[model samples]
Target: MTEPRTFTLRDDLKLALELADAADAISRARFTALDLVVTTKPDRTPVTDADQAVERAIRTVLAEQRPGDGILGEEFGTAGSTSRQWIIDPIDGTAGFMRGIPIWATLIALAVDGVPVVGVVSAPALGKRWWASAGAGAWSSDERTPNASPTRLAVSGVDTLAEASISYGSLQQWDQAGHLDEIVSLSRQVWRTRAYGDMWSYMLLAEGHLDMAGEFDLQPYDMAALAPIVQEAGGVFTSIDGKPGPWHGSALATNGLLHDATLAVLNPA
Candidate 1:
């Protein structure tokens, strides 16, 4: 494969940031306008609109800025063919968004030859955004202090499962995967557990506030932007079964020290 030099890492990061801005506008408006009354379960129409709008906005920008680069979006599907591809999840936690929870975000990543080198997660409702490049340190900005310098992120140092915290995206996901028992058993072994769900789970893990996060039934867009940030923050990014990279349908992220142990617990013989 020839080296594709369409954009610098910095340029891709900037594009990710711009897409985040567009995503925030679409997500925030639809989120705030949601009825939020869950009759039994959440409705999907609002999120559908938000998802399409955000993705369309991103595709438009990419079409102009990096026409040579390809795009694979959750809402829009795949397009173009450069080895350098943009993977996007316009809203990562549509269930949370529908429920009026502020945990969802827009995820954007630049993956070269199937490895993500740039990532951005923007959650406007939570007033937060986290980003990282292959080498740049993982950093986050709190909406509470927009003018302040971004705080660098690092994974926790907890080396033992008995002293580590974990976030599994959702119990429903585990149950659907027929791994609810495994999740329950693992939860009992961990220091603590929370189904923080979506980008927040990994963000918390990257911040050293949590140690492990895993989820199933995800697409590449959902995991691409998150892998680099977690890895750059001194964590490990792998599939639930321990394969590396974001192509897997599931993910397991942990502080580097406890990654193997967590995988062992989840993938016991």
Candidate 2:
């Protein structure tokens, strides 16, 4: 197998777009097949299928195009090296999806020596895909607008917590993590709040439509794809405790201006 090309960010960005196409195919199909009739709580089969299928598709492509590269997937586990690993989460908001909500998507990212350098979020049901490569601008496409160029994205300038809008992934996640009060406190201090519960929240922030995004109990795949997009869009991406990377098990993403203030509020004594 040939070594993976250490392409420029432009090439990486193009690959991210191709990966989004593959992910959308598997994800949208399963999403459409889901019954979405929350009888009791929610089901996981639809997400499991979508997740595995999407990861398999990505793996197949990487094997052919970047043979020496590694992969870490939510459904398939790890394979190959970590030097140029591809991380994937084929379906990020299974619960919302199972309940007939449109907040789910597939997250694809390339982490070089554990630092995510390229990221893509494809939510077909929502008709949007967002992506970014290190040093490249963040971008998004709307399937609703056929053939239109993807718009460059940027974070908002709401500098104060009182003026910022925020979305934490899930109330249940915070409650389970014993940080519900901290989350609630932060929400009250912020101008707006919503548990958009997945990729949608972060994408909204990257588009300058929201000011803050944070969550707990996340894996690397959940946060990796988000980091580059948020960073490229002029936002800060870090752990809730103010750590600078996605390995910290929690996340706090905000337009660069409001990051520190949001960190102060999210940190529990």
Off by over 4 Å in 1: 1-5, 34-47
Scored by CA lDDT, what does every candidate get?
0.89, 0.84
- Using all chains and alpha carbons, the TM-scores for the candidates as numbered come to 0.92, 0.91
Error of 1 at 216 (Å): 0.9
The alpha-carbon RMSD values of the candidates against the true structure, listed in the order shown, are: 3.5, 3.1
Model 2: which ten-residue window has the lowest total lDDT?
A: 36-45
**Candidate 1 per-residue lDDT over residues 1-269, each given as its tens digit:** 98745577988898899889988987898885654332232423344667778899999999988889899998778998878999999989877777678889999999999999999999999899999999998999999996899999999999998898999988999999988888898999988998888889899999999999999998899999999999999899999999999998999999999988888888889
lDDT of 1 at 257: 98
The candidate 1 region of ten consecutive residues with least summed lDDT is 36-45
Who wins the TM-score comparison? 1
Q: Tell me which residue pairs clash in candidate 2.
A: none
Look at candidate 1 and give me any clashing residue pairs: none
- Predicted structure with the largest lDDT when compared to the true one: 1
